[model samples]
Target chain A: MRTSKKYIVTGLFLILLIILLSCELMLGSVYIPAQNVFSVLTNNEHQNEVWNTIILQSRLPRALGAIIAGASLSVSGLLMQVLFRNPLASPYILGISSGAGLGVALITLGSVGIGFTFVPNGLSLVASAMLGALLVFSIVFFISLKVKDVMTLLIAGVLIGSIANAVVNIIQLHASALAVKTFVLWTLASLDQLEMTDIKLLYIICPLTLIGSFLLSKQLNALLMGEKYARSVGVNILLSRILIILFSGILAASITAFCGPIGFIGIMVPHIVRIIFRTNHHKLLILFSVLIGSCTLLAADLMAHYFITSVSLPINAITALIGIPVILWLLLGKKDISKTI
Target chain B: MHTILEIKNIDVSYKQQKVLENGSLTLKESTLTALLGRNGSGKSTLLNTISGFLKPTKGEILVSGVNIYKSNPATRARLISYLESTPLSPQNISVKELVAFGRYPYLDLFTSLSESDLTIIHSALFQCGLSQFSDRFFNELSDGEKQKVFIARAIAQNTPLIILDEPTSHLDFIARREIINLLKTLCLKENKTIFFSSHEPELCVELADRFVVTANHTFSEVNKTEVLKTLINS
Candidate 1:
């Protein structure tokens, strides 16, 4: 029987999430009082100009950016885990991020000869990243159809990653030092420099994609077993797989497009939730993954925000510090995850 | 006896290699049938075809006297549940939580668990002797315990017919007999038709109400006594 304690744990997690998210909004470079923050939120006409700009222009967008990035990456990771039925599988595992890096490279290199005049200089780079993520998504999706084995798909993913890295390096070699620096900075994956427009675009896309993922929770849970098991459970394997890939592509592409390719949070949050709740219940996992992801990213973002007085660290660096250890612990515990194959 | 399933002249292939040719079988309501076969003998293939996981190249799989291939898969799942030989054990899931997944076919999208669904899950856990271990992590359980948890999930599906591939392979001899007896009790008490493939020919003959033997990629029915004899001779 379910207990009151379970409800308490869930409530506690929610409270922790709220505290972290609020701290994310309040604890930036220019500090604002709690009362002033509330007034800026509610009394729009009466608030101070500096407070209004900080809350509206800087803090709100940054908080939203962190949320969108976190949810997308975590859910993307969850979907890949189900699609390949591997604990280590993630959206970044297929080398899509590296491919997106290549796309960003092409755009940053100032290839005016390429088509699409509608894309302006900065936006073109983002679009190229999206296209790169899409291309990688298609390749991995296609390979999965041919190879039923998860390990084979992983091998293919590694091979694709290697090839994509080679291409990215080739692009780097031809580009100028300044462009290479710009590309390298982007690859570090930061949460800063998010404009209001970028926030709006993410707001529009990420939630819609997340809703689509929510609808496919049962299907994803079924896929945790193999395809035959999924089908026997009444899941349409083809349709579900397509939807998963599509949603995952949007999330991965969005993060890579705006914030660069951040890893670990995507791959780690679902595993964390699985460990906490002791269930792959999609309904629970889907909801909690978003929450845990937001909390994890916000905590990491805080570290990035306050770690150095002189300079802010990239978000991915903080995540790597936290995530790698959990992974190491899982591996060292002898869980026999690889034996699933 | 009312017929629940009919497999008519089924020919199945994996890409180009033919796996099952003109395979056919019929199942009556409230019967327990054991599927016996060697490795690569198309036993799992037949189960897949029958469950609508794979469409046979040339044949019809009918469930509840309706061709399952024609019925939309969601509806077919409402009638049949198939457990794979080596299913992925969700690491963090408890026995109770995994069994609750069986209600997926009954509930609509966005519909949370109703009281009936909880009741079914509770009963399944009880039947599979997992009532006491409902909170234990699935990965922490022994292989025999995990097999019972899987059976509990199938039981929670609440379908009239259930299919399993090699359900007893994970258990020791004593645990194997206990699971077999548990399955037999389910068939008798609930009037649910059960079908599972097993390598233990003697166990199948002793336990199952009917025997379905797959030899040389072909399936045929044999009397329990004859199946026992065949096992001895082979």
Candidate 2:
């Protein structure tokens, strides 16, 4: 009975993801018809050249970016929560994204102050972002080793994020107007700005790391009981910890490098998946998190694009608006949130 | 019965401070050994060292005549199953699912649970008298029930030897008696070696086959008469 229920729920999530993906491709500024979007996607000859260009160039890449970012962040969030054994843990809440943001900020804004005229290319941004994320994650990991209490580590992550944000703000103060503007817009976070080349890079990095996370499911299941128990079951705790950090760091860093620091999706999606599935098994959790995460971001991106006719709101704002309430509800509804994880 | 677990003169320490020095004990198969110690008496440390969680500074532990420290984690896991006091009660995990975690060491990364693995899990549940509670969430169970679930998990691991830290600490009187009886059954019926630390020596004196007391930074096995005299005096 449980097996059949899982299959049905998994199928439903897949269908929802498809519907959202189609809506993301169809509804946009120009409002291309669903059939036209389908034809364009299928490589059929469309009558309107402008519609084809918009569907292929703008909507397709943006939709794909939403899927990648959503799945990557959500999986990373689930990893963090399990690793730390804290329900509030996520890539954004633990300051990993801010670390990536700081990396991007240094490259984009700090170059203006240094007067080096350095070009912020895709490779440079990705490298810096990953370095920053790894740096913060290493600190968090070290702190976790020293302190058994996860709440302290959460606080440390927030403080580290604050420090990174402060550094970004200081660099912005010294940067040129153009550099500051670009950095600010990046902080607002968007999916429409990613080029096809960037999408190709994301496709390589995110899917491989996601697969890596899936492969670690057994270790993760062992970890769900705690470190000592996991070790008793022959899990190499140190190696598992390092691999989890590496995978999550790369996932969060690559997405932030491409689409800015998208928040809430990582932390929010896993909890939703856990509630819907009513199981703590990582294999099922990781699969549904990916599907549900993709659907969520696609819907959020759609709202961000067409919520208001005149002004295009930041994707960050829409996600925050959707995510904060869920977080609040999670906090208020549970007397002790840590028990839920 | 043959000696299944042999601990040579081993020193256990936390950081640089030594806790147990030259601690040694040996246990035969199918016997229940109860470890009695006062608060902060290094019983847990000794248990951990024996279970391969801590590296003893100057000795070797052998399970079935194989030096456990020289073996890999998988070998050690198969040799000994350990249950910590107050295990985490993870939410949304069913009793059967948690017990299935015991089969992790036997499974490769890509392989799912085979028929034999499921059989072991079901038998463990049945042994613990938790067959009806297999579908319930772990966190929702009462404290005594949760402890049984953990024991069931250890049983599912299918190890020859099992060690537990303060197994009856938080349990009520009836629950504690039930647990002690259950551990006794596990030893005699399942033919497994059981070692567990406990504060209540009186409750264990009736069922325990042997007693090892931790005091004065060392461990020593005492016969029942001596332990009874000590208990009566203290």
Candidate 3:
């Protein structure tokens, strides 16, 4: 009976995902008919070359971007919450995005655009962003080892993020006007402008990291049991901590590297999954989180693409617009927020 | 072997402040022992040191003749299971799932429960009278049931030695008696060595086969907790 219910929910989610995907394809700036979307998807000989270009080049990547980036961010959020044992914990609060943003700022700010080198410019961003994120993560990870207090470690992470943001602000000031515009535009592009190559990298990195997180589910659950309690049950605290941090870092960094630092999806999607599923089994949470995340971003992208014909709403704006109210309601509700954190 | 756990003149300190100084004891097999101490008397420190969670400044603790501090976490876990006196109850976990986590030390980084693991978990729940409550959320359970779940988790761990700090401290007398009864049953049936700390000396005298007490930074093995009570007042 339980299995049947799960199947029904999964089926419903799958249908929603497909409809949103189709809508995403049909509702871009240059609207294509729903039938054209079907032919284009099936690779039938559609004579409309413009429809073909928009679907294959722009809309296709954006839709795929929504699926992967959304799933990655959401899973990252769940992992962060499990790791920190804090309901409010997410990649945004931990500032992995800020650190990656700082890296992007450094590269885009000046003449040494390594993208001009043998490595693809997009690939360069990935490396720099990953590097910056790993650096900050290492700092936080070390602080976690040294400082036993959770509040202290969280405060230290916030302080590190502030420092990174400070550097980014200085870079914004020093860079040329074009550099500033590039950075600004990059920040605006969440799950858009993802080159096929970057998408391929994401296919490899995201699933690998996500799988790593799933494999660590048992350890993650142990962590929720309280560190001391977890250890008594034979959890390798150090190993689990390192793996959680690494997985979260890689997931968040890749998303930021490819699609500018998108906000709130990472924080929002997991809460939605938990609310919907009413369970915290990591395996189930991870699976549902992925599906719901994909559907949400696809829906959000559809809205962003079709919200205003003249101007496209950025994905970040759409997510925040959706996220803030949910957050406020959660706060206003009698959820005993302290117990969760 | 008569001795299941041996602590050899161990010293524990935090921030260079000594908590337990020159503590030594031998825990016999299949016996229920209670560690009695005042607040800041280092009952927790001593238990932690024995469990290999805390590194002592000096000396060794051996379980089944193997130096626990020298042993790896996995090796130590195989020999002994531990429980903290006060733990933040985790949410969204079922009693069964929480008990299944006891198999953690045996499984890989990404653990998969085997048939044997499942059987062990069931037996643990059965022993704790929690088989019916397997699907119940941990936080929703009563305090007494929650403590049993902790013990059941440790029981499923299947170690010869179990050390708990203050398992019955906050519980009512009935709950306290229940926990002691449960521990006594575990000792008799499983032939396990159970060492638990408690503030209530009278309760310890009623249930424990042996008593270890802490006073003025020293841990001394006492034949009876009442004798130690008299010594403390003196």
Using TM-score as the yardstick, the better of models 2 and 3 is 2
Report the lDDT tens digits of candidate 3 across residue range A1-341: 15578789989999999999988888867889998888987899945999988888888888888899889989998888877777878875667778877877888884434344122276677677777777777787788777765567778888998999998987677667777877776676566667677777789989999889888887777777678877776677777777777788788877887787878888778877766555667878889989998998888888887868677788888888887787667656636654542
True contacts kept of 1: 0.65
Residue-by-residue lDDT tens digits, candidate 1, B1-234: 788888889889877888878888889888989988777788888888777778888978888877888898789888899988888766656677678778888877788679999999999999888999888877789999988888898988888889988888868999999888988999889888898999998888788999987776568888977886654443
- Mind giving the per-residue lDDT tens digits that candidate 1 earns over A186-282? 8888777777899999989989999989988878777766777777778877678768877887888888888888878988888777666655767
lDDT of each: 0.80, 0.86, 0.81
Binned by DockQ into CAPRI classes (incorrect, acceptable, medium, high), candidate 3 is: medium
lDDT of 1 at B109: 71
Separately for all candidates shown, the number of backbone clashes (residues 3 or more apart, or on different chains) is 1, 0, 0
Candidate 3: residue B183 Cα off by (Å)? 0.9
lDDT (Cα, tens digit) per residue for candidate 2, span B1-234: 889999999998988999999988999999999998777879899999989988999989999898988998888888899999878888888999999999998998789899999999999999999999999988889989999998998999999999999999889999999998999999999999999999887887888999998888888898887876654443
Model 3, range B44-71, lDDT digits (tens) per residue?
Answer: 8888888888899998888999998787
Provide the RMSD of all predictions against the true structure, rounded to 1 decimal. 3.4, 2.6, 3.2
lDDT of 3: 0.81
